[model samples]
Target: MPDSIAPDALRRLVLPDRVHRSLYTDPAIFDLEMTRIFGRCWLFLAHESQIRAPGDFVRARLGREDVIVVRARDGRIRALVNRCTHRGAQVCQAERGNTAGFACPYHAWTFGLDGALNSVPHRQSLPPDFDLKDPRLALAAVPRVESYRGFVFGSLAPGGESLVEHLGPIAAVIDNVVDRAPDGEIEQAGGVARQEYRGNWKLHHENANDTLHPGFVHESSVSAARGDPRDYAAPAYDGHQTHTQMLSNGFGVREWQSLSLTGFPAGHSYMGGFYRGGVLSPDRDDPVWREYRARLVARHGEEKTARVLGEDRFNNLLYPNVSINAQYQQIRVVTPLAVDRTRVTAFCFRLKGAPEALFHRAVRFLTNLSSPASMILSDDIEIFERVQGGLANSEPEWLDQSRGLGADRTEAGGRTVSAGLSELPHRAQYAAWLRYMTAAA
Candidate 1:
């Protein structure tokens, strides 16, 4: 592939079981992805709970666009471009806060929370024909915004699939998260943990559900946990969640093969949970989990609670930019800074009526998996950079994704399932990538 990729050339870049290396290294391809993939798809923005009150807002990224996700006084959530319409300066600088309106720093042109032009610095200086109500003078708003079980998403395109249609069956994973709460609600409790890596953003999603790499890429952390008896000595130990989680990644070949991985047509996928007997395990009977279960039972009854707690999916990827582990109340959002740079922001949720200890466990899970100093994520980040560095070479122009290509079995719901170690998720993502990259813009 050349530096300048045409729409027709994109199909040849992504094959049945291999993808061209230029997809990761080409600046032109990355620019096209920003407009076609991220711009058209419904990218995850802010959780509804994050901005529950009127005037509350948080700065977010919509592909290459900086946006402010705000709740207006009329109880509506709106995403507005952060740039000032007057002088092209950023209108909001804060990460998150509550305010009545935003005033541009370069000039005093102010806008309402809904991105409506409210006032100008010097109204008399403007021509009499200039109207304040002109839509072009206000901040640019994302064309479409929707929420599914409180997880907000925005699309830059004016028309496309609705959020529900786009999510397909993956919405059930989100439902499991919210349904686990006794009050049927979850809120963003802890502050976000962000880490920047020197690699393409696609690498994160590619590695998210790859069960085979954990035993190799994260061997140091997994071996350390395996060598420590404290990780597995006690069944009810609550403090060793991180160590136990590390140990879970050290599963043998047979154990990994026994697990199941499923891929969707829309680029979403998830793997069956591998943690069997740790505090992070769904079937664990620790006191904190017992209390949490009892609370859920009180609200949802025995059968419903069992169904909620029975879900065992992990690393649910929502296409281009989001990975959710609803079982642990964790969400990681990936943002592409450049062709070779990416940022991941992670947030943990608190079950509205569950015990505080459960929320603490969720926080610990988030830290162990996504924090800058995380044992697992640091290793993955190092490998991502190394992959990026290696791809700088011109040889080996194609990356193989045929690990388990011929063995995928389609289930009743149109999802393809395979052995856990298969690279089906990568292929699924590329299928969607090709569709978006080749579509008419």
Candidate 2:
């Protein structure tokens, strides 16, 4: 356990447009975050589609606690601690599977899918006072579990804000993801791609909404794609480079401009310009794209369908832990393993009832962009490690996120809107980070 630091001292670490490097490297600060942020905030769990059948379960983690998200025989989903109450041993080992119940290998103690104490060996030999209904004897459960459009979340805190309230304006972005499904459903299509980095987890979420770095950091990949061997050494490539060219090669340079970045309360934000011009204009001519669009058009009018498809926010930062890209049909979950190590898992989602080719396209994007060995992502991971190492030097105590500081304007629902290249997303995140880290538990 880490000794608690005064809240005022913590506040000084986070400034309006700058933050102390210790926030990313301090073990004590990381411990406090595990309690204050991860413990209270609603963190994304397995999707509802993952546990469709009774007795189906998937292993998950809430901060430091290992949990099992299972569908009970009674058709209810529950998140239970994976530890056995009797001897403190893990009860479930499978990553995900269907089972009648979990039997602890340590003592043969059994728990039902709903986490109820179902059986114990040597019943007659046990103490007469042993009570099966005791709360401590049953498999412990997460305090709260909820889902929005099949994306499930669990909270360790007993009470705070509901999942919808926590999501706020970001809920619309999530809706864009699910609503894109022709039948209004999305499922885990392919297995997840996992990667681990020797850097803080916050860097991953911060980078998700950082649009200013792509043109510079990924210039090699872009140059390779564009067949231009010229080095990206000029200042023009810094923050003024072509936005569409910085993204995947599928998008044409003339098709779009710098994206719109929106930052809302609770550290939520999204960045993309493709929402205006549309993401799949080329795919518009494909049979798979046409078939899927027709289904959506039948359900919603042609105008509404076009608007939904065009609302292409490339990456959505779901606060502290998850980054979702609906356009790519990928959800990336960040797990902090230590003060300096973080693990990321990217899962591919398939729009239910959409054409098979559409699913294949999603997988191709996942492989080419989000995979651990991806050309684009490898550059990001390398930079994160470099940044982590650079923070260790004894020179600058604060990191600057001053780009577009005063340029952001307030929008409806208290959201802050600005050009996609702005650092408003990082500012929004640190604002929430300061609040959560300093607030009373």
Give the winner by lDDT. 1
lDDT for predicted candidate 2 compared with the true structure: 0.82
Clashes (backbone N, CA, C under 3 Å), per candidate, total: 0, 1
Residue-level lDDT tens digits of model 2 in 77-132: 89999999998999999999999999999989999887888889999999999988
* Candidate lDDT values, in order: 0.89, 0.82
**Per-residue lDDT of candidate 1, residues 206-295 (tens digit):** 999888999999999888887747456566455668777888888888888887888888889998855543435845667888888989
Q: How close is candidate 1 to the true structure, as a TM-score?
A: 0.96
For each of the candidates, the C-alpha root-mean-square deviation to the true structure, in angstroms, is 2.4, 5.1
List where candidate 1 sits over 4 angstroms from the true fold: 1-4, 228-238, 276-279
Candidate 2 ranges with C-alpha deviation above 4 Å:
1-3, 228-257, 275-283
Q: Clashes in model 2: which pairs?
A: 275-312
